[model samples]
Target chain A: MQVHVEVLNFYARQMRLLDALDVEGYAGTFTEDGVTDHAHRGERVEGRAALIAGAKLALPRYAGAAVRHWNDHYLIEEVDENTLAVSYCSLVTRTDADGNVTFEPTFAIEDVLVRLDGELYTRSRTIHRDRPAAAA
Target chain B: MQVHVEVLNFYARQMRLLDALDVEGYAGTFTEDGVTDHAHRGERVEGRAALIAGAKLALPRYAGAAVRHWNDHYLIEEVDENTLAVSYCSLVTRTDADGNVTFEPTFAIEDVLVRLDGELYTRSRTIHRDRPAAAA
Candidate 1:
């Protein structure tokens, strides 16, 4: 069973883009018609344009805040040759207005990804098992 | 490009168990060595026995709570023949101590799944965005 190295690299790149708050690179991770459903925010931004806009809106809110977020512990339930369902844990670190750094852990992000033109792009994502204390 | 149907079925069943809070059924989804990292709970339960135990501990706390959880909008990125990454969103319904039901939306979940022994299992996962708001 050979694991897909590209998928791992993709995830790693995503982490870097997000950590750096590079909205363009983050938006590039999706397809042109990609959709992002933010359950907690109660907003769904569809298409590359809107997705980019959302990223631009949110990325800077935390400016000057030290943050590190990573996810590991994965489960991939294949939906088909072109699709997959995955879930994992996410840990977040950030410095507050008081200059206190906080660590927050959350659970099981469920997502469905599709392969388009031999490139993997996100279609949708949902988050579960989030607690305030977990967010630290 | 043939999608793996069995994997989809497994994930669908797992989601059903979670929405229903069927502990036994939920525990049945993983292999004997399966583990769940409850990042929010800050606990990692390894193997089927521990997984079941953890579910048993948490299920009751959700009793009497109106629970609604659903997964949709799949974005799958194939890394190779045997590995994949995905992200998706979840919508949840909960009831408070006062019996008030609230629906909360969450962030997208990202994960990496590996196929082992002709079966797909979670290798790594990350929760990128998670937010919960008042019931709509």
Candidate 2:
């Protein structure tokens, strides 16, 4: 499979696990010692265990809604034979039981993916929340 | 150059054209005798000319807002050497100048695409508005 398609499919599966609140499954998409840097919040969580812990704590915020991450404008680069640098814009939506939908602020994300036995897994991810331009 | 990746890239470009309200440019993404069937509205437009005309008429509706179609769950099937059947769920949003966003009803769309001169173009599109399940 092509790298672009592989990367996209990886995200499709990873995001579904996340939105479904399958914390362990979501963490499985990353390397054992993967790092996630919340650049906007200046918080970095390292390793799959930490990822699972953080995700568990965040679960309550989505207790009664279906949260989805819609991503676009993917830019992927081959950093080496087995490494990829990827980035995209993400928009999140939460749909309640009544089917009303609400949005979260947009975000930009970058990641480093490495091939493990022909499958891709995230080695690192950095997320930046989108903000309006400051007045000059 | 996998089919799945190609189809996604095609949509990324095509949706941009539609959202940007580049009527002619958008129409150009279809074949000369393409067809658009708005199943929910019972409108079937045939040919590039008709497509362009219908789009132009709808342009006024998007005058002040930037409309975007966020699509998910793309399913692609190769029907022949140069033909593909594709389907996906689409979520539409319109962002106003003030940055507030509103959504249109969700839609499920199926499309037939043909490859001509190494590029893909829509030959037929059928769009169905998603509706709640009818009471039993």
Candidate 3:
């Protein structure tokens, strides 16, 4: 069995937008009142605008770092006909100035996605960090 | 929408077994041939027996730590109606001997689950740690 096409596309777009630092585009992937929980950092931000603001602040930290995100694999469970619970592994890497590559960070993301008006948007995201923010 | 009862039960049993430090029981959650990728630790353990051995080697690290795991939420995706992809968030807390409690770890896990002979077992697990193990 294979993953749903829409699910794969969603992550692909997300990764592209994030790596490109398209903050607005990336934030657009969520609902207007979506929520993101960065549990490892003890951070929670709700509402699309606020999520955008948070990303705006955080994404810059990785600027010029050549960070790339890979939402490598996912498992999906249908919550209902209109909603899906999607979980997957997120692997991140960075290329150094000297062209060396190192593993930056990796974790799992548990997200709730709803199909509204025939389009899918993330309603909530909870990132489980195997590595914690405090430790960093 | 709600998570499937059986899927939820699987996690419940796995969690119960793990917190109890029941290595054999915990390993039983996996199929006879299962894969556990502790990538951050550079550990790739295969087979139920090896998984149990790995648990034996690792569980003692938390012997006196009063550790507990909470799997808060999950997203499920179905593949062929028999195999499923499940992802979830894990929050771990450790209390000291004095009863001081602090949130120590949070992470996400992505797993491949297969239904076999009217039962479900974990086939593969890939954990993404927000924090890297090398630093820990």
Candidate 4:
């Protein structure tokens, strides 16, 4: 399979696990020492264990909501034989039990993915909240 | 490139043209006699000219908003050597100048895409608005 399709498919599966609140499953999509940097919040989470811990700690915020990460404009680059760099825009939505939908600020995400034993896993991710363009 | 990647890239470009309100450019992504069936509204628009005309009529709805269609869970089936059946869920968002986001009802869309001279184009599309699932 081509890197573009592979990377897109990887995100589709990984994000589903996260949106479903499957912390362990979601963390499994990453390497054992994966890192996630929330640039806008100045938080850096290192390792799958830490990732799961952080996810669990934030689970309560989604108590009665179905959360989805709607992504677009995926740009994928093959960094080398076994690594790929990918970036995309993400718009998050939370639909409550009563069918009311709310939005979190949109974000732009960059990820480095590596191939391990022919399977893809996220090595690192950096997220930046989107802001309006400054006046020129 | 594989069919999966080709289809995804086709959508990325097509959606961009659509969200930009470039009605003529958007219609050009379809075949000369392409058809769009709004199943929920019982409206059928046939051919590129009709598509452009219909889109122009709806342009005023997006007067001061940036419209976006965020799609996910693409299922692609090769119908034959040169045809593909694709389906996905779409969530529409309209962001006003001030960045307040509003949503249109979500939709499930099915499309038939055909490869002509090695490039893919939409042959037909059917859209259905999403609704709450009924309890058993």
Q: Say which prediction, candidate 3 or candidate 4, comes out ahead on DockQ.
A: 4
- Model 4 - which docking category? incorrect
DockQ of candidate model 4: 0.13
Across all candidates, the chain A TM-score values are 0.80, 0.97, 0.87, 0.96
lDDT per residue for candidate 3 within B2-105, as digits (tens), equals 23667878888888888888889888889899999975467789999899888888876876667777663356788867799987656566777989765443
Model 1, C-alpha of A15: deviation from truth (Å): 1.6
Q: Once model 3 is optimally superposed onto the true structure by TM-score, how far is the C-alpha of residue B32 displaced, in angstroms?
A: 0.4
Q: Give the per-residue lDDT digits (tens) of candidate 1, residues B55-133.
A: 7787666765535454556667788887767567765546443435455546466656667777666564454346465
lDDT of 2 at A81: 97
The docking category that best describes candidate 1 is incorrect
Interface RMSD of candidate 2, in Å, is: 5.8
**Candidate 1: segments with Cα more than 4 A from true spot:** A95-100, A104-107, A129-136, B1-136
Candidate 2's residue-wise lDDT over B1-136, tens digit each?
Answer: 4887788778877886786688899999999999999999999999999999998888778865667787889989899999999999998877655556677999999999999999999999999999999999
Residue B35 CA displacement from its true place in model 2, Å = 0.8
Flag regions of model 2 displaced more than 4 Å. Answer: A9-68, A73-89, A94-101, A105-136
Error of 3 at A72 (Å): 26
Reported per model, the fraction of native interface contacts reproduced equals 0.00, 0.06, 0.00, 0.11
Tens digits of lDDT, candidate 1, A14-132: 77887878878887887777777767557778888898888888877677786766564346656888786666545566776788875443344677777777777778767654532
Can you give the lDDT of residue A42 in candidate 2?
Answer: 99
Q: Candidate 4: which stretches are off by over 4 Å?
A: A9-69, A73-87, A93-101, A105-136, B132-136
Model 4's chain B yields a TM-score of 0.97
